[model samples]
Target: MSGIKRTMIILPATLVYFLVMLDSSIISTAIPQITDEFNSLLDVGWYGSAYQLASSAFVPLAGKIYIFFPIKWSFIVFFTVFELGSALCGAAQSSPMLIVGRAIAGLGASGLMNGILTILAAILPPHKLPRVMGLNVALGQVGLACGPLIGGALTEYATWRWCFYINLPVGALVGALLLSLRIPEINTKPPAYEVLHTAMSSMDLFGLVLLWPSAIMFFLALQWGGNQYAWNSAMVIGLFVGAAITSGLFLTWEYHYGDNALLPFSMLRNRVIYSASATMFFFMGVMLTAYYYLPIYFQAVKGDSPLMSGVHILPSIISQVLVTMSTGTLIQRVGYYLPNVLTGTALASIAYGLYSTFSPSTSVGKWIGYQIIGGAGSGATSPGSYIAIQNSVPRAAIPTAMAILILCQNLGSAIFLTVAQSIFSNSLQNHLRTQAPGVDVQAVIQGGARMLRPLVPAQELPSVLQAYSRAIDAVMYLGAGLGVAAFGCAWGLGFKDIRKKGEEGK
Candidate 1:
């Protein structure tokens, strides 16, 4: 395709991805309104996690569907499902209803990014893919980074329901645009019975069944381990044991299923894809941990309202948007992606180190600068994984590689959130016990971030505030550790220039 024709297809596809990702994190700022309306404080974890769990579990299946089916029609089906879920969320009268909506939406989202990148690979040449891939990721990051900002605005000025309702029109527009776009088509699928057989075999339904149980049991164990139940309690231990057994079973099934498995064992043996996945895993863990806890720092420690906290975090997301776009362009021009990865990881590490220094009364300028540093690092490296997938694999395998990369990103988010929350909770309780002995720690825990100041007496408020900042800093320290881990993984990418098909870069 000509450059202009390719750009036309890329724009609408990228917008779809942007909306998919925006919904993922936008709920962060609107949780207060959601909980207040439904009176379900206990279900807050499910609000975000349901979407994540469903999205993570269905991704491999989505990848298989994209391969066996036509991209355009497959995309339309997923988008329709996503739109239906959005409408359900906007009209939800109960917390569980909204959680169900989010899960449905996640089911739809599971395939959108994979399909978007797959379409781009089909239409664009290797030399130009990285720049546009970066652009797509940059836009997606904007949606994720600004989700809190947009959701908070809607929640404060309009209604939290608008946060989801907004997707309806945008999806409608993209749905129309997709009708006219041209993308590469796979081999002709057989008849209906053959399609059903493909779903059973190629889609690896048994592997998916095992995968969901394994992921859910594992996630529940992590989520409830130190918070709802003691880590060593029978419930938590049983969940972990269930997770391990199911996971082992899933692995055995995948190995037996061979090339047609959800995550093809043969495909993963590639050194580049394996190492690139690890790099993305660590990077995503850092991103989710930092993005999530920094907001808590703004709310619990800095005394910002949820809306104001979103405004305060804009410097970070804005910086990320700029850096991610430019990094892609730079890689296209210079021919090697490793330099950008190295630079971004180092800056993110530094950003975490700076975040660990936040106090109850950090200077405004200092916080803003720290956000910029963190955002830039994330932006610089975010596109590298996508670039790596296209560069290392044949075009036919792009969907599968994209699936693996995205699965890592989702898994990273889910696992890191569980770990960071534990770190924050344990550290806060320890601080409260030592620093503010007279305060009712359990009451503060139930009351949550917005309730802390109101729950504590004036004399103990300062100590409690300090405790919050220190606890948040402990989470930042975890982000710093992830940064170090990601930095090490990046070196394993083995230097390459996407623009030069036969050339390797040192």
Candidate 2:
């Protein structure tokens, strides 16, 4: 492929990725309005989780589709379906409908993201992979970074409805661009489901069954533990037990059934894949705490409108975009990921550490600086994990590793979000008790944000708001601690350059 063609292919793929990520973060700014329109706090978490859950649930399926069909057709079909989902989300009238729309959109997004990586792996030369992949990561972050600002602006000026509506034009443009690109058409007739059946003769179906449900249970436990039920509630206990049993069964099945499994036992034993994924787990956990809680902090503590909250998050997003692009080029030049990962994590840790110190009185300059540091850390960490894993594994195994990496990342997000949510809510409750003395805890909890709106006379509202702000800051501190843990893991990866110029030419 000529340089011009490579650029053409990469640009559209990157834009597709950017739109998907943008939708993810963009919706955060509109959440307050979404909740009010639907009048469902219980379903609020679902808005984010719905999209993620759908994308995550079917990630493994993308590989199957790719293997069985032509890549170009698969991309076209998936992208079209995803855009349809986004359109439905914009038009949704009820919470369930919205969740359904998000899930549909996620289905499409899963393919777009995974497909982009697959195409990149096929097109980019090995030595240039890291740089190009970094660019991809940066573009994706651009969506994530600008999502809030764009979503906020649109929601504030037009309507919250436009948050979803905006995807229509953007998605259309991306689709048009992708249509113009002429990519290689894979012609292999995948050995029939007959081969899969033959392969499955030795495969572990039990592990397959256990893996997804176990993940779902565990994720649900994380999402629901603090929010819906008390930490010690029977529901929480049941969820944990279910996750543990299913996970145990999955391992047991994999060990006994042996040969062909959803996740080969051998892959797990690879120190590089395991350790890198572990780092991602912690990294994603910290990243997710920010995604889930930052908006809450903006609205509840900062007294910023939801739209403004999204705008405030723009610094973090923008920093990630700029640094991630640079990271790709840097890694390609250095031929190792350790320094970038380590430096990135350390910066993130500091950002989080500094965040722990946040109070209502914190200056905007200080917050923006911290966001930039944190964003850069995330940007650096993001590409290295995938690139390291991709570089380490055989090309054939890339899809499996990619799926596993994505699974781990999303699962970690679900688990950590739960942890942070518990901390935030508990801290808020504790502060309320100390400050108001005789106020009804149930009333405060039940009222959500609305209770404080008018019930607290104007004179005492500042103290109430202060307490909420302190609680949010405390959660951010906890997130910082998690970042430190992730940094340690990244540092331990021990830089190893895996790319070879000779490999790409084959």
Candidate 3:
């Protein structure tokens, strides 16, 4: 590919990836409004779960599909499909329908991380890959960092539905730009029959069958356990057992079948890949858990409106964008990954620790400081992790390695939020019982609305609100603990700075 062609492909691909990522976090602050509008707080959990589950379930599958298809056309197919899903979400009238739409979008989005990476590797030299990947990472961070602010503004000034609707035009434009660019095409014809035969011979069909159920069951169990069902209830127990059994089978299958496997066990054998993937899992979990729950602390405990809550979270997003941009450019210049990883992780750990001290009485200045620390940490680590993983592997292993990284990330995110929320509930109940002896702690815990709204009697409202604040603080503290663990994992990352001109230049 020539300079202009490469620029066109990279720039547009970056934009599309950014928009998809933005969509993931954008609707969070609007959840309360959606729940209220639909009168289905019970179903709100599905909104996030549907997207996450679909993305996790199908991402690896997309990786396999890319083996038999052109990268350029595959992207066009997936991005268009994703845009269609987004449009459906914007037009959705019911909670279930919205979830279905989100799932469809997830299905398309499942392909994105791997898609861009594959394209970058094919066109760019090994050394230049990091800088391009860094650019991709920066674009994604831009989406993540800007999501809340954009979502909040849209939700506040117009409507929450616009959050999903907004993706349509952006996606279309990105797709158009990518399609118009004339890029070099690889001449290898996909050995579809042979690839399929090999895939069937080597792949674990049993594991594939078990994968979705295990994920779905585990997610549902988390959503319901403690919040909807008692931890020891028959329903929760059955779901948990099903998830464990299915997951065990999947693992066993993967272990037995290495190369022809859906998940290559040999890829996991790479020390650097293993360590980097594990670190990604831990931090992705911690970061996502915070994203899901932090706004609740602002809205439920601090009495901020949804739009205001989103606005409040904006600083962290903005700071992360700035940090990621600088980090990306520097990585292009530096040719190593360790310094950024160590520095970012150390800063993030401190930020998370500081955030754990949050209370209703915590000042705005203090909150901003905490967010800045965390944002900068995020900026440093996000690109740093991707660069490490991409740089460590050879071209042959790139797709599988990227797939594992994303899978670990999604699974970590799903597991952490479920576990974190469970921890929060158990702690909150204990705190409420001791503090408000006569209050209906169960009611307040189950529906947090009574604690949030002005409709509740003014006399008991203060105590209820106070309890809510304490509960929020406890969850934040718990998240902080998780973040500290993530930072420790981040510190373990072998940082090798790969500068823009390549490692040889340094």
Best by TM-score: 1
For each candidate, what is the lDDT? 0.83, 0.73, 0.73
Q: Comparing candidate 2 with candidate 3, which one achieves the higher TM-score?
A: 3
What is the per-residue lDDT of model 2 for residues 1-506, given as tens digits with 9 covering 90 to 100? Answer: 75899888888888888888887777777766666666654455567766777777666566545555556677888899898998899899998999899889988876777788777776765566777788888888777777777876877788877888888888788788888878764335455565466544433444556777877787677667666787689998898899899889877876665435655668777777777877887787776567656766676667677667877887888888888888888887777888888888788888888887777688999988988888888887888887887677766566666766665665565456556656666777788788866566555555554345545667667777777777778878877877777777776566676555424544
Off by over 4 Å in 2: 42-44, 176-182, 185-208, 256-259, 437-455, 498-506
- lDDT of model 2 at residue 180? 81
Candidate 2 is scored at a TM of 0.89
Cα lDDT of model 1 by residue, 1-506, tens digit: 77777778888899998998799878777775575567654455566667777778988988888888888888888889889889999999898899899889988888887889878877776666777788888889888888888987888788989989999999989999888887766444456577786677767898999999999898788777777899999999999999999999999999989999999988889877877888888888777666666766787788777788889999998999888778878888887888888888889999999999999889999999999999999998888877877888887888888888788777777677667767777788899999999998887776767677778999999999999899889989989888888888888777876667723321
- Model 2 local distance difference test score: 0.73
> Model 3's lDDT to the true fold?
0.73
lDDT, candidate 3, 1-506, per-residue tens:
75877887888878887987787788777766676666554554566667767878877777666655677887788888788889999999988899899889888888887788777777777777766787788889888777766776787789988999998877768877887875443336455577667665543455577788989899889878877799899999999999999999888888887776768888888766766777777776656655666676787767777778877987788778888878867877766676777677677777767766777788999998788888888888887767777777776567667877787776676676556666666666777677666667656654543234644456766666666667656656656666666666665556555554364534
Residue range with the least summed lDDT across 10 consecutive positions in model 1: 497-506
What would the TM-score be for candidate 1 when compared with the true structure? 0.94
Best by lDDT: 1
Using TM-score as the measure, name the better of candidate 1 and candidate 3.
1
Q: After superposition, how far is residue 501 of candidate 2 from its true place, in Å?
A: 4.6
Residue 373 in candidate 2 has what lDDT? 89
List the candidate 3 regions with Cα displacement exceeding 4 Å: 42-45, 182-189, 193-199, 202-206, 424-451, 495-506
